[model samples]
Target: MSKTVTVEVGLGDRAYDILIGSGLIARAGETISARLPGTRVAIVTDENVAASHLEALKSGLESGGVAVAATIALPAGEKTKGFAFLQEVVDAVLGARLERRDAVVALGGGVIGDLAGFAAGIVRRGMDFVQIPTSLLAQVDSSVGGKTGINSARGKNLIGVFHQPKLVLADSGVLDTLPIREFRAGYAELAKYGLIDRPDFFAWLEKNWREVFEGGDARIEAIAEACRAKADVVARDEFETGDRALLNLGHTFGHALEAATAYDGARLVHGEGVAIGMVLAHRFSARLNLASPDDAVRVEAHLKAVGLPTRIADIPGEMPGADKLLDYITQDKKVSRGALTFILTRGIGQSFIAKDVPSSEVLAFLRDSLG
Candidate 1:
């Protein structure tokens, strides 16, 4: 029952708003139709979430008089963010005979949103898509920006497009059904907002961990507020020209770990990888004298307080070899001339984009963190 925060992505004719609030899912059809006006709708979801809230979502859209053709469900996982599955989902939408006037809905976490959004981007030159994020990670981060693409063997999100959602519906009520482990994983991304640039926000998160985890309305607003912050940045720079890169605060290292871990096959979750990567970025920054060691400690402490991973050892399974960091991290988009352009924190609230971080130094710090 809080105010609905709006982040307008100023794309001229394609500009859209991200409305964040609780109970918003109930009104999804009306809001989505207001922006997306396509008569035919395809609800793309994963098996996990489809079983729980698919009916409610369908009813919402149906009540708004939107005709839903088919509901496509993909298997849930980080592995789903790749070509093979995306092709099938696209096929499903096509089989439904959706035309240029129709739209698709992504109703799940990052995996579904990314894959479905990719389908919306390429199938028939372009179609509208909506994000009904069931997970905190997607609700606050991935589902907002128009960055949609699948992973490649070369790296993560290597094959993607910037297909913005017509509207993003984050139903906070969905959080209660999420497993505690999954909730913790999403919290990593939530903490990342502060680690990247909002140090005071990080401190605030540390003080209110219980309310956030146990489900407090104010904390829900905080998540929406963070989404608004990111939405504003994405609105200004959708294609990551300048300010949008700020959103990738811990993503460079986090992505490298995900690649190393092979998209978390019995290894780590996306947010967990991000948790480890953020700490490494700061530590490597300190090793190069570009960032302070105290900053790294505080980052680690905050991650640990939430029971999130902050080191290599925290990875539950055998992760990628630190000795192979150059090979793994070198695939990042930020890399050039075999050097990783690390996103490092100068202090708790200050971060800077630093390039020329030696691959060797990054490897050494990775080794130290694992111990």
Candidate 2:
């Protein structure tokens, strides 16, 4: 029953709140039932999470007198975010006879949240969606923004929509079950908010990331701060038309690496790819004379200290060639009609969108980075 910090994503009528605290899952029924009023819910989760936390969630909702009309658990991991599983979830929601007002509850990590949210967005033309994010990454990043979708074979998150959730319950206590690697992967995204604009938060993380990793007050504070940063950006640009694109700071290179790896969690998870991609972005900015090399070094040092993979060389197993990697980059969602767009930096906490960057320069950087 620790104090829950609530961050509001203010989108007028479509706005929602992200509640972060311990024991929120056990109390989820009270909150969700209060918000949606007599609505039934369909719980969409993965096999892994269903084993770990599904019963508790069901018990919580049932205790609050909310009926769980159906439960659909899919196989876990990044591959589950595709047409096949999306169809399964859609079918399950329809099979459950859920109405438009009923909620589609995502009770797992980023994979489950994205898949379930997308299902909620499209089923019966968008039903109410609730997110009970279990992973540190999903709690702080994916669970907050309404960017819901599955991955395309072409690229990560290429096939998604702007479907905001009605409410997001982020129980940090649940993160205790996550493997150390998964937690670290999520930290990459938390650190990203600092790198994007909050030099103070970045410096704070540099000094206190150890405590943040150990969990407790430091962890909650970090999650709340990251949520606040994202809430502000998302509130202002829900569709990523301008400043919102900054949220994808390292995603261009990161998503390319993901596509290169074919979205395999073993080789490179999303956040690890983001860690390496952030380093690459800083280094590439320095190469373009847009930022100082010292900035890139500092970013790399912090990421490496935290056990994140900060370089392409850190990825395990065989990697695609630079040409293939370049092709993947070109296919990134940031690319505008064959022109390159990247989030470059002038220094720490000073990221900006650089559009129409030369593809030739990017190709050269990829070649050197491969070496």
Candidate 3:
């Protein structure tokens, strides 16, 4: 019975609502049924999520008289977002005999959302999909944006499409089941919004992050704010042709690290990589005199205080050398016409896209970081 906060992603006819609150999953069937009457749905989730909350979701759907045409549960983790599983999900949806008007429900974290969304986008020339993001990362970021795809052998998210969801249900209550580490990793992305262009929000988070972690009004407010920030950006640049690229703030270096680790969760997760990459982006900006070194230090301090990895050395196990890491960066999707593009900063809340960055400069920075 908690209050629901709704944020709209304005895309003309394609617009949708992101409903944020507690107990949303239990109400998902009713909400979705009202939006697309008589349409059946296929629930695509990961094994971990299926074991935890699938029953509750199913019961909710059944209560609303929504039929689950099929259910496909893949293995959980970053590795699941690849060609093999993508094929598996596509086939499951196809095998279910779901018509074009049917829906695909992504019921887990970013991996499930991305993979299921990609399947929904391509199957039968695209089917309607609803995103019930169970994780903090999915709720605040991936679930809202239309970006969907699997990992490429070359890089993370290199093979995706912009497939916006029909609706997004973010149940803050679900996050209570998240492990502390996973929750903290998600906090990194939440903090990214502040660093991207909301210095005041960043300061607010600095003061109220503890309550956000504890959950309740603070947690819902924080997630809603992050979603609002992203919704505005996505509405302005849905295709990521211009200003939307700013959202890639920490992704360049972060993707490189994820690639180097071979998508090994034990080594690093996406948000952890992003946390470290944001720090690197700031430090590199300082090295180029684009921002003050104090800014980099402050960024690192906040991330670390929240238990996110903020440095190369923070990663567990032996990491690849600078040259190897650089090789991965070259394969990143941000590379344009063989040149590097990065979201660098001039100061807190002052990020801009830097294009055609010299490879030599990046190499030197990587060497220093690796050392």
Off by over 4 Å in 2: none
- lDDT per residue for candidate 2 within 256-311, as digits (tens), equals 89888877788999999999999999999999998999999999999999999999
Off by over 4 Å in 3: none
Question: Which digits, one per residue and each the tens of the lDDT, describe model 1 over residues 168-215?
Answer: 788887888998778888888888778767887888888888888877
Question: Ten residues in a row with the worst lDDT in model 1?
Answer: 1-10
lDDT of each: 0.79, 0.92, 0.92
Going through the candidates in the order shown, the clash numbers are: 1, 0, 0
For residues 1-371, write the lDDT of model 3, one tens digit per residue: 67899999999888999999999989888999998899899999988999999999999998988999999999988789899999989999999999988999999999999999999999998999999999999999999879999988766788978889999999999999999989998999999999999999899999999999999989999999999999999999999889999998898999899888877888899899999999999999999999999999999999999989999998988899888898889878777788789999998999999998888899999999988
> Which candidate model has the greater lDDT, 1 or 2?
2
How big is the positional error of residue 74 in model 2, measured in Å on the Cα after superposition? 0.7
- TM-score for model 1? 0.92
Best by lDDT: 3
Residue 86, candidate 3: Cα error in Å is 2.2
